[model samples]
Target: MSLTQEQKDAFKAIFIETVTNFAQQVGQATEKVFLQILPLTVVAGTEYLKSYEEDLKTKLEDCKTKSQKIIGALSTVKEPEKVEKTGDKHLPLGELLGKRVQRGEDWKWDDQDGGIGSFGKVVGVKGNGWVKVQWESSRNENRYRWGVDKAYDVKVVEIVDDLGDIPPLEEQIKKPTSWVIGKSVVRGRDWKWKDQDGGEGQIGEVIDVCDEGWVEVKWKNGTVCQYRWGGENAFDLKVVPKPKE
Candidate 1:
């Protein structure tokens, strides 16, 4: 977005005011001691003026930088439709689609087949609080619903801004397999660190197996994550016999 003429004028006035006030203050200070230190004062005042000019230049540059940042932020402001409030929900399509999100606080992590801390991208909107999400660990798109109350609703999907150490989308969309739930698996000896779900050589139970080649594993350490198996030569895991109690 381009700045309005009024805004440009306002900024120019501010810069002029700042420079004029600073010059006036410096002139007044120098005037008070002008006669007392005439000879040597000229050289010292020249050096001091040079330093002051440099400092003022830096401050002006900083102000310009801050102004540009403000303009950039204003340019990114969502349109009316993007912030349209639907009851308690304030997010619009501009904020949700293509955004990274995590399961909400009220998600049924334990009761459901999925694990906690899963992340996904909002790929489509079905309106009325429903959205299609392409989960980070699977290629299939799942439907997620938003709650009426965004602050304390069970259906809220938390937006994730920083991805941190999450695996890339390229590695997450592995081909599907025919693995069954309840099967036990361990990291194969040939498994590399790059194929990690819950660390190398860790034993885990198959909590859920989707047709999209995504196998959700609950590790001995209680951490759960999805991994690739079966198709596309994804041989990172080896099925192991369940240990008897």
Candidate 2:
């Protein structure tokens, strides 16, 4: 079967064209299949991711609910009752009522001086965590009240069976007396001037004694002002006995 050179060339050209056409047809078919499956693949992947996200969301919600339940349980659980230590013994808050307490025994509130070293008997206990104390210095109608925590924390008061007896209201509070004008006096303890010029231990003269326990004083620095005698000023004035002329 020997063929001429021209015939051999024609056969080679036809074989090359047929192979190229077959490769082009195969490539087009593969491209068509990929285009048809791409949308479905994307949709399936999206659905899978959505399901995973929803599962994670559900888990997070469950965790949150469980945390809330745990917190609620902790909040509802009653705390163990604590026994407060006083001196050598431990006592509860209920036993503190009717106890005798002294002022300045321990730190209470900043403004409260623990009754200023005076004794007090617990008269009543309030549900709002306050104990009513009848101070020895206070009148019958007047009572000092303190928080339950402070009453327990401060070693000022102790449980006492006997408080002796309460004095009459009239005896507790002294009667008002007239102040002699031009009387020399020294500023008492914790005395502060309104203008902050003079203070405790400063010398002054009583110019007048007004109603409502207010006393007008002319200080050595020539500052004249009125102050509440036994109130916030707490001015303890010691009268200087006038020397014989």
Per-residue CA lDDT of candidate 1, range 32-129, in tens?
A: 44444456558888999999999999999999999999999867753333334454234653245445566665454342313566666655554455
Which residue pairs overlap in candidate 2's backbone? 101-157, 103-114, 188-236
Task: List the candidate 2 regions with Cα displacement exceeding 4 Å.
Answer: 1-80, 84-90, 104-115, 140-153, 156-245
Per-prediction TM-score, please? Answer: 0.27, 0.26
Model 1 regions lying over 4 Å from their true place = 1-176, 194-201
lDDT of 2: 0.52
Worst 10 residues of 1 by lDDT: 147-156
How close is each model in CA RMSD to the real structure?
Answer: 17.6, 25.5
lDDT per residue as tens, model 2, 76-126: 744234554546222343455546665433344543433456665554444
